[model samples]
Every structure is written in C-alpha cells, then in structure tokens.
Target: MLVPLTREKFEQLIPLIATGPQYKYYWGKFSNFLQRLLISVVIGAIVLLFKVLFRVDFPLVFIIGIIGAFYWFWGPVFQASQRNIKCRRYKYSGFFRGRILDFWITEELIGKQETVNNKGDLVIVENREKRINLEIGDDTGFIAEFQAPLKVAYKAISSGQWAELLVMSNRGDLSTIEEISDIYIPSRDLWVSDYPILRRDFFTEVSSRLDDNEDEDDKPRRRRSEGNRRRKRDDYRY
Candidate 1:
C-alpha cells in the first residue's frame, strides 16, 4: 500500500521534489550523434525504398529527417515529460530515508570497432555510475542498493553521513535515487524541528509497515508470556 497525501501536501512536497534531478530519458550509452545518424539513415533508406518501389513523389529527405528527429530527440523529450508526470501519481514511492552504507562507481570497458562512418573514433570506452548501498528504517538490518548519480552528494558520501534519500521504487525494489540530502542526526534532547519532523515521518512511513509484521510475530510470544504470568499467579494463590 502507498502513503496518501492531499493535493496541498503534495504541492508542498513538490518544491522539494523539484530539488531532485528532473526526469531524463535513459537513452542507452550510445553517443547521441551516432544514435541520431543511424536512426536517420535507416528511416531514410526505408522511405527511399518505398518512394522508388511505389512511385511516390514525396521527398525522402523530408520524411526521413522529420521521423529521425522524432525518434532520436522529440520522442525522448516526450517520455521525460511523462515520467515526471507519473512521479506525481506515484509520489509515495519517492519517500524513504536511509543511512549510506557504501558507495562505488561501476566501471566497464565498451568496445565498438565497427561502424566506421559513425561519429567519434573510439575502440575502447569506459562507463561509470555511482552505486550507493543503503540501510533503511529502524531495522538497520534492512538494506538496499540505489544507483545514484555520481555528480551529486559527494561530500556526504565521503563523510559517511546519514541521509534523507527520496528514492524511486520502480519495477522492483527501491533502486533509483530521485533526490538525496545530508541530514544531521538530531540529538534526542533537542526538539525536532519542522525539517526533522519531515525526516522522521518519512522514515517511519517506510519502516512502519514492517513494524506490522513484527507485531504479528510478537503476538505469540506475548501470549506465552501472559500465560506464564497467569500460571505463576495461580501457583501463588494455591
């Protein structure tokens, strides 16, 4: 089940949501210029073939160029728009607080010796991504991996600090980080401020559901304890 928030509450949180990285269409690691050109050429070839075989007068360049732009550029822009919109509907999926347990950048070499006419010359390429492992909720035992952006949250990562991570639980477990900020651990003696309340509340929201399961597990033990106490009392009465 997802947490319910009023429109006004969602609006209040929207600004904070804006603080996170806006949606970006995850275009595969293929370079933009190559993607565009290859797509355009394929589309152009098809358009030209159709024009020749069917004896159509349409200019192949115009048809293919427009289609290429749509697929390579406009399509992704539209997808990004839809993703951010979907975020509104799934807002509850974005609220989770965790302690950063570990962080690492994924590095792999990509080799592409073929396609000579394509953009830049690169026989060997290296890919990198920041992978952050987090321990969520009161159950410090609960852990998950989030593929976060390397450019953001370097200081906190280096300092080994706790964070209020607004993560997106996509298809599976919470894997993508939507936003993150360093949160100073509040001293218990000090009053938790508004921000602190927001911090504490979101974490509780994520972890509280688990507490229900814990409650279910404790019932048997609790009953046994109660039984033991009653038995002891009866013995004393005798």
Candidate 2:
C-alpha cells in the first residue's frame, strides 16, 4: 500500500542537511576515511613535485591545500548535496508498506588487504564479507530488492515480515521508484540497509498520519455495508 505525501511536506520532514544519522553512516566508516586521505596525500605529493621540479607557481601549491581540505572536511557535505539534488528531482514521497517475499545471503568482495607472506613478501589479498539480499513486494505488484551487510541483528529477519519504505518517485510515473530509504521491519523493530536515509522520528510521525487517513477512508464504506444489511432484512420480513 502507498500513501502519498506532498513534496513540500516530505522535505520538511527530511530536510537537506549535511550532518545527521544518515551522514554518520558515510562519515564514520574507517575504510572510506582512509581512502579519501590516501587520495588527498597522493594528489598533494604530485602537485608538490610539480612545484619543486618544474617551478610551478603558487596557485598549484594552493590547489594542493584545497584538495586536502575538500577530501578531509567538505567531502561529506558534497556527498549530501548530491543526494539532495537527486531526491529533489522526484515529485512525490510515498509511505510504502510491503512484505518480505524472499531473502538470500552471498559472499561479496568487500575490499583488499596487504599482508606479509611466509617468504617475507607483501601480497594483496581479497577480503570477502557476507551480505543479505531481500525481495520485498506489496499487493500493488511493486517489487524492490534491498541488500545489507549480514550482521547478527539481521540474522533474525526471515520471509513474511512487514517492510516499510519512504519511496520517492515522479508524479507522472509512479511505476519507477526513483529512490528508497532504509527498510524498516516493524515486527522486529529492526532496520536494514547499508546506508541510512530517513529521519526516524519524522518517519514515525508521518506513518501515524497515513494510518489515520486509511481509517477515515474505510469508515464510509463500513457504514454503507451496514445500511445494505438492514434493507435486506426488511425485504425478507415483507
């Protein structure tokens, strides 16, 4: 089931901000931090060499500082900006309730590590980690696949659990899902995703409003059904 929210309301709940729990997921990763530092160092070294060997001007040296600053300080902000831009292109935000149809685990290459062999030679080895993949769908026939690292908490997830999503899509084309937040499993009170996107507090508030709307919509239909039953009873007596 899909309950639509206006774009303005959606943005109000999920504001475009550089720092949040979602940004923490990107900023807190040690591997990502190391990778960015390595790039900055390598580029800075090259630029320094240009200045020393080829007599490049001060602008080139200044560029090295800028590169380091970008990778170290402004990287997360840049990433957040890009995500916000992509999300803004979509015209609608929807509260999607669905069920987990199936799931599987697979070993994925996470990264590589350098290790010393018995012969005292350094060698690079592939690091593999387990990841869980899930297929979720609703009665409306919309199906989406989600993946997350296989952790102890996620091991409890099985088929037939309820899944909730904050889905973004264009008004003219709802069939194509532009983006989705982390999957929320209400039964287990667990969330699954490599990256967190939605603001949990705001999500809970929106969910309640949607549920109330559904209840309000059902009231008239229920009253009409009762009236029909009363009419049928009178005709039978006559």
Best lDDT goes to which candidate?
2
Tens digits of per-residue lDDT for model 1, 89-150: 54334433345465566533333334333576644433544433333342335444444333
Query: Model 2 misses residue 217 by how many Å?
Result: 3.6
Model 1: residues with Cα > 4 Å off, grouped in runs? 1-30, 57-65, 78-94, 101-132, 139-142, 149-153, 158-162, 167-238
Clashes of each: 0, 0
lDDT of 2 by residue, 106-165 (tens): 999989999999999999999998999989998779898888888889978989998888
Model 2, residue 180: distance off in Å is 2.4
Clashes of 1: 0
Error of 1 at 162 (Å): 4.2
Local distance difference test values of all predictions, in order: 0.42, 0.74
TM-score for predicted model 2 compared with the true structure: 0.71
Q: How accurate is candidate 1 locally (lDDT)?
A: 0.42
